[model samples]
Target: MATRRKEYRFRNGKIIEIEENHDGNYGAPGQKRIKKKKPTEEQMRLVNINNKVKRCRHKLLEYFNAGDCFGTWTYSQANRPPDMKAALKDFQKTIRIVRIEYKKRNRELFWIRNIERGTKGAWHIHFVVNEIGDTASIMQKAWKKGGIYAVEIRNEPKVYDEDFSKLAAYMTKDEHTKEIKKDGTPAKPRLKETSYNTSRNMPLKKPHVDKLVRWKNEVKPRKGYYIISIHEGINPVTGFKYRRYTMVRFPEPKRKVQLKRRI
Candidate 1:
């Protein structure tokens, strides 16, 4: 009887051939099989960090869509810009001041802040914020340590999704701040930086997970909270599959009580 052969192409463009003998054996006898190496500790740590960053970005997007997001704004550095670390500190302090003043006026504010490098390699600030009244002027006045600023309210629903995805992609893009040396070691220790920030009062995401049943079955109809989105991924460290649900909880609806005694 003639043997049947099959070929498989991997993502790396490697072609592997397999033959079946009369006895239904796949590989030839004494042919050693190459085993996949487990991920190194450093690699696993990097994977975990990547997953965490992605989840945080998605949560920020969910927060933006679940409620009213005022707009997206950018703040550029002035002619004499401070160091990145110092500039970030000053930026955060200004934001806190803005939040405090807004609250004093009995207005609520929520913000998602992102820091990025501009075309000239200068650090800039981006924010998706919700605040009562006109905030662009206030932000401009507060961020006096920068050059120019712009704010555009997100009008269209489709634009929100597009902008959200773009922001997430930008935040997660490969960072060029660190370089790899020829010896496979990093040239210098990367400076710790906050990629993004969110308001403290932002809604906390609720996770609903079920292995044997669908997501709908696992999540019940809650009064204050509603499901925003669901994401499925494998844990990089444990390799365990999981389904994460992003939920938004609003102020509970008021219930009416009957006056039975009067009746």
Candidate 2:
């Protein structure tokens, strides 16, 4: 943090401008400065683990949203390169029965995939094709009979509120924060590290270089924790003002890129 000293450089008394050093945002921090509280050793380890799990979870969710019946089956061939065409072929074969069954019985159920980086050095799925059936044995037999080892039978564990507990376990369980020395109650909402854009600081209303550009092009800026550029929530539904700054579940890059040189 450099001090802004009022020193006059007089060639003539017109006006000379000087920028404060470092500006508190950019540049490397040397040993003299400490930015934030140093977390405990345990805290750092847990944070690293959580970040990995979160990344894996994103891929898992992507598979489901792309018309996957159960999150259990992976598009990637067990540690081998993904054969999407083969996966889709298998998908078509599996769902043809499902679609036929649906028409006859109207099963509008969605599947939930329980995935983990397996001990066998392959990503595995404990696929429950749909939650609305006792079809575990049926599906397992079908896959084996049709030669798809990737589709396996791993049902919900025998625990109270089986499905709910699993989801809560993932969502609620987070890394421990720095242990406060004195008595400090854990806050209501858990803390999670998020991708923070450097454009987190809001621009003051003096026609800042950023705001002028945003206004001219009429692009929306996102909200919350901006240091440089601005953000406005652009909801296709009720619109930005009615919405809240969304939780950072994925990496959204800060748009502080300068394209002036390219043009």
Candidate 3:
């Protein structure tokens, strides 16, 4: 088996994944292949949702950085849309206005949006958008029917790794997971729907893959970068060890000013 590695570089950090490559042929000639059981429908659903979450996280890290805004937007009682369709339409309209506002200032808008309904059937929106000079103000003015509550993303390595993972999980949370209602009774999951959306301006870079030649046993950081986290697991199907880690550049120190002695 050949060792393979993949490297993904983002705006704030980088991820490296390494694993063993198993050839497509499962067995040698005349070898009886064991038939694996097919995945149940529910299992397949969860797998798909998990994949969506990973993809969402990758995009968020690739395009967004510190000082960006991440928050939820809700509609007033009177302005609540009747259905998901209407909610999406209103959201699209609002974003279109936001894009125009950014364009007017010669800034390009990059955003990721997700829409979901609460147990009571009320709809709301979650978003991650690049912060310009007037992002909050523009969004607030454009979304007249709702009040936008936003918080700025912190300038930290964890914000790009752990925090982004949490954000992406929430934004892409599927309706397939069973949950308890407020009444303490098990509630049925809602119908599966779209996971999330990204603006066309987002640019996703392809990861570089090659034969694994370094860091096979120990997770080490590069000269100018530091490791944020490392995860190790075994692939059930392949029975091979898998490892992934994240690295971020060290922040440069501020220049010190020297005081001059007067004669």
Best by TM-score: 3
Q: In angstroms, how far off is 194's CA in candidate 1?
A: 5.8
How well is each residue in 169-259 modelled by candidate 2, as lDDT tens digits? 3422332333343567554423332111111122212111111111122322234322222223332221112111112122356889666
Query: Whose TM-score is higher: candidate 1's or candidate 2's?
Result: 1
- Global lDDT of each candidate: 0.50, 0.32, 0.70
lDDT of 1 by residue, 1-263 (tens): 22332222111211111111121222235554333458888768678656555555545554444234433334443433455676577767888888887887888766766665544555666666654556766776776655544445345343344324444534443343355689987765233333566677755343322122112225342355455455455655444344434344555569999777864
Off by over 4 Å in 1: 1-38, 41-46, 66-81, 117-121, 152-163, 172-194, 213-263
Better of 1 and 3 by TM-score: 3
Candidate 2 minimal-lDDT segment of 10 residues: 206-215
How well is each residue in 1-263 modelled by candidate 3, as lDDT tens digits? 34567777776344432223433224334575435556677667766776687677777767776678877788889998878788888988999999999999999888888887766666678888999877878878888767787777664332344527667766775566565689998778763443378888766677777774333567678778787767676644445456767777778899999999999
Off by over 4 Å in 3: 1-3, 12-39, 155-163, 177-195, 211-217, 233-241, 252-263
Per-candidate TM-score against the hidden true structure: 0.50, 0.27, 0.75
